[model samples]
Target: MSGPFVYVPPVNPVNYPPSPVHYHNSPYLASFYTDPNSPFIPPLSLSGNASPYQSPNTLNSPLPTVLTPNAVPFPASSSGSAFAPENPWNRERRVSWNGSVAAPTVPNSSWLQPPMYHYRRRSDAAAFPFQQPVDWTSLSPYAPYRTELVQQSFIHPLLNAEDRRNDLILDMSCPSFAPMRNIGNNQTAPITPEELNQLAFYPQAYGAHIYCELIPDLPIDIRYRPLPGYSPIAPPLKVGDILAAIWNDMQLGISQEMWASLDENRELMISRAYTKRCKIWASRGFPSMRNAGVKKVDCLLGKVFFRGLVPTGDEANTLRMIVA
Candidate 1:
């Protein structure tokens, strides 16, 4: 099955009107400026040459000249923008994240090294985990982190003792927000040894990744599937707790970015993720971490309640046969 996917909105509207023009300075801005309420831009010297479209009739007002029918489109400026100079799309971009935090156990990481840092292997599926500390220098917190909090853990607790099975182990599933590489500060600046120890203290405490990197073959969003055995059959008292959380999320949906802030700062994360890469890969999409941008992650988390139109599932053989 594919991953859950959805339609994305355009950053800029289509069939957009030509942007308003902003001449650095127009001599006419003084007498015929369209908006006196707005401060006048300092006038720039127009080369002595006359504009081809400067006609006596249109010259009466600065704003009218701009809308003149015979006006030749302004010569494109090479340095600034493809869209009209005043298009909001041309504004500067600013990316921000939580402040730079040092990991708890700062190992020698490539993040500390110069550009094009080297990456190395750390985790092996066959090997027992948590026997000793993982050398995370080879990995980066900014990259998708894969801790033990994979798909199995999501429904594992809900599983009955007899129904529980680890055969379908998932690696890149529940990613919390904490322990993310410092996108805001450490991105450009080098971290001190002290910050290293602070970041690694318990990276998993941050919470789950917004998008689950489960089965690789499926579309990231459309393929929402959970095993029948995954959801537990809790007795009575626990049902109320589940009901409350459902009410909170369903009736009171939180903004994805706000949730990320709260999730990363939580005293205790429902789960954790490791920065190490796994040796084995899964066939289906499970809840796991993958390289996703903040906007994409926000979109994924925001649609927490979206459902698929087709039959999304992990039963490969059944799906293939149905397609046939």
Candidate 2:
């Protein structure tokens, strides 16, 4: 059942179009009344309907020359459709003005959705795209041995002589006068707070001389010279042997040493010349002597037990361990 066509005046005449002008048309457009009591309605026919001005049996009266427009082609039949379109984004069932029937809820069930993204360790990057290799910058070959480092002293030690002498000679002629021939822990005094805090020292070897070395933790390319009497290619002790022997017990046994007898006397003397060139802990321990500076190693010529050098005159108490 449709309403009859009528010449209902546009409440706003300007909006209807001036006089007899034609207008654009779409299948989606609808006609409506502004006043509730108005009796006229536009013809229901599209451009298919004949114009009232041009023919008999046409739309009646005042709006006789209605602004009928030419229709555009429709995509589909307009049956069972509304003037307004269904929302393209309307994903769920919804109610309409006419009926209870609504669009079935879009099947949001798992069967209709895309499959779950499965992940596995694959050679392809897509599997673990964000994954990365181990951060080797944070790694090291000597990582395990790094625990040996201790807290360093911030304060400086009091001025002290770098080289000290001890009368380490034993006199067989005056037997009873000098009963003590062998040096022991009792000969050394207890450590003072200053020595422990300001100096880096091993308490066991504080007064006694034990072989010490400060090998650089980094790999170095060094062209070195062997001892005066030893051959350059086949020295008495090699880099590996020295490192192993020094670390074995710190103090190597005198009677147990199997060494080639060569310049024995000159080798025993850890003279001032050797001390100045060696890497004494006090020298290398300083920040100024590290990294960019040239570094030397403290080498032991003979075993820690072997003796030829000793303090002269009154320098007995401060018999500093001379490193050759």
Taking the candidates one at a time, how many backbone clashes does each contain? Answer: 47, 2
- Segments in model 2 whose C-alpha atoms lie over 4 Å from true places: 1-189, 193-251, 255-258, 261-324
lDDT of 1 by residue, 1-324 (tens): 998986653333311112221222211112211221011122344654566354533444333234464443333645433235453346676856567875666435444544545545556734865465555654544443344643211111211112223121111112211111122321312222232222111111111111123212222211112234433332211211211221122222223555465545331221111122111112223224233212121223223222111212454111110000
Scanning candidate 1 in windows of ten residues, the lowest lDDT window is 315-324
**lDDT: worst 10-residue window of model 2:** 28-37
Clashes of 2: 2
Q: Candidate 2 has what TM-score?
A: 0.14
TM-score of each: 0.13, 0.14
The C-alpha stretches of model 1 lying farther than 4 A from their native spots are: 1-161, 164-166, 172-255, 260-264, 267-290, 293-324
What are the candidates' C-alpha RMSDs?
Answer: 33.0, 46.5
Could you give me the TM-score of model 1 versus the true structure? 0.13
Each candidate's lDDT (Cα)? 0.26, 0.27
